[model samples]
Target: MDKEKVEQLKIQMQQWLNEAEEFINHIPPVQLYTAVGVVLFTLILLLIIRLFKRTTSNTIILTGLSGSGKTYLFYQLRDGSAHQGTVTSMEPNEDSFILHSEKDKKGKLKLVHIVDVPGHSRLRPKLDEFLPQAAGVVFVVDSVEFLPNFRPASEYLYEILTKASVVKKKVPVLLLCNKVDKVTAHTAEFIRKQLEKEIDKLRTSRTAVSDADISNEYTLGVPGEPFAFSQCHNSIIIAEASGLTGEISQLEKFIRENVKP
Candidate 1:
């Protein structure tokens, strides 16, 4: 009886296979090819979109004038402690890792690729090499010594804000005022107003020069009005941090916002 049932089941399976083959054979060559092409095209398009999203940059650039404490901030973010006596870096300090603050979390987190570009006049050109891949730029400032370095700091920031890569891509910038734990540190609001004033002055003088003579790919601010961070195409945020005391929550927040977990 078992053998007889097995034979019937085999015949039923063979009949289904034959019917399926006949149905396929009845399909016109054009219709079959079109259906296959549609499926293949859809798969290729989905694959391309996935690749594009995965390629989205995870780089965060820390840049500012010499003595602005960018290196300290970089180390603090990666190591969670200020490694003492860190002098001005001659070369770019770069690393890809999960932020030290996030390491204690339970689940897997995305690694942030951070580049601390040296702020010396000659090394400033190196910033162009990494700006293309930057998810966000943190322009560090020495809040305790801001007044003395205000002009130069603003000039450097002006150059960065005008770059074609920064402007065209609308890469967000965080005007990070570092070393705010000190007694005489300036407020982030004060530093922001001062920077806006200085950048406005720069815009005036720079716009007078012929476009060919200017290295900046795009002019900053509106032609007739005063320049403000709010007027730029890219978003500019001002925040405070103390790399020395490891009070970098704002900086970490900015990084996480730009480079998601």
Candidate 2:
């Protein structure tokens, strides 16, 4: 019975196809030509959209102090695994792929180009290579060890926010406080306030020093008031994450918000 039904369906499909061809054959030549032209135009338009999406800025830069776990977070984003005990990466960990969180989506997502710039003092300069084209910047901070590294981290972040490339492009910055799984980890709000205070002091000191010393390409924060991130030209978002335990949804959200799939 099933076989007979299959054969009948096939025959019906063939008859329908023949009827469709006959109907198309009767269409006026000009109308048929117009229909073909419209289809071709639509196909070309879709192709252009695909090409444009492929070329759009997909870069998300990850940078922070050596021990802030930015490299670990980078691994988490790319592989969804911490790859524990990762020493300070000497070189930038860079790749282009669909985010690990979007792995199940196959073929329907855009590739993200992530540049995990090494946070070492020497390697930090390499960040400039990718910053100009970055869709967003994820600056990881070690919330559990926040106080000890606050100065250098603040200085590094200050330089970044003040850089000509970041300021001119107005690239959004995500202040990611990592290692949040730890009980000792600081809250995102506290971290933000401390960072603001540190940056405010640095801004004043930079102003006191020679313009060359500060590389004063673009002044940061308001001239008179204390430096709050809100005063900056670009948008700043504060969020927490735990790279080891893979609680990085907020981080992923920021990337998607800026770099469309």
Candidate 3:
């Protein structure tokens, strides 16, 4: 071919390449915006899932009479064994939230934040503050002592239930009949029945009002009902300060099932 023809061919090829580059640069802004939007949307989705997990977790507050095993359960939950003695009140500097995480039988994660409040009658006044913070209440009862200590336990239960009801929230209650291994006749089923009877009696007494008795009346706060009542199915009770392994696991499972997350 001639040099002039070759030069013309080169010029036509250069012009074609320049036009292609300009056309590429003029591509729609919508496509570029869509690419950026996808990246931002992915980031937002991840953040929402993380926030949902944190928000849906439940917090439980354990309350019962002194020597009712609230502290024992707390220690068992923390260490996976009830080997430690009842945890005494912490110093002013210590944090109040005792958070523990354990895996369920199916390998699902279970998080529990147990607020251990003082069980003595004197500390009853402080329950108002604690009860409202908890999503559920684990009311530990000493099964062996129930016969001798029934009056005080019943009164305490009434008070707690009333206080809980006044807030217009029906929190689930787990009646942990602790120390069941000590008694020969007191099976978990038996304890459950007795407690249910006692609860019914309490409810009846509160609601029973004669026509003439309307002069003076009293009302309960919790509506004379329990949120969730169950017996501790484990046989090894009397969770000593050394450790309460068998019973604690049962209690943990019960909580995970009934307590909403």
Give the candidate number with the greatest lDDT. Answer: 1
For each candidate in turn, the TM-score is: 0.84, 0.77, 0.56
* TM-score of model number 3: 0.56
Show the lowest summed lDDT stretch of 10 residues, model 1: 207-216
What 10-residue stretch in candidate 3 is worst by lDDT? 232-241
Q: Which sections of candidate 1 miss by over 4 Å?
A: 1-27, 30-47
Global CA lDDT of candidate 1, please?
0.93
Give all candidates' CA lDDT scores.
0.93, 0.90, 0.59
Q: How far in Å is the alpha carbon of 222 misplaced in model 1?
A: 1.7
The Cα error of candidate 3 at residue 219, in Å, is 5.1
Deviating ranges (above 4 Å) for candidate 3: 1-57, 86-110, 164-167, 183-185, 197-245, 258-261
Tell me which of candidates 1 and 2 scores higher on TM-score. Answer: 1
Candidate 3 lDDT over residue span 2-24, tens digit each: 99999999999999999998976
**Model 2 C-alpha lDDT versus the unseen true structure:** 0.90
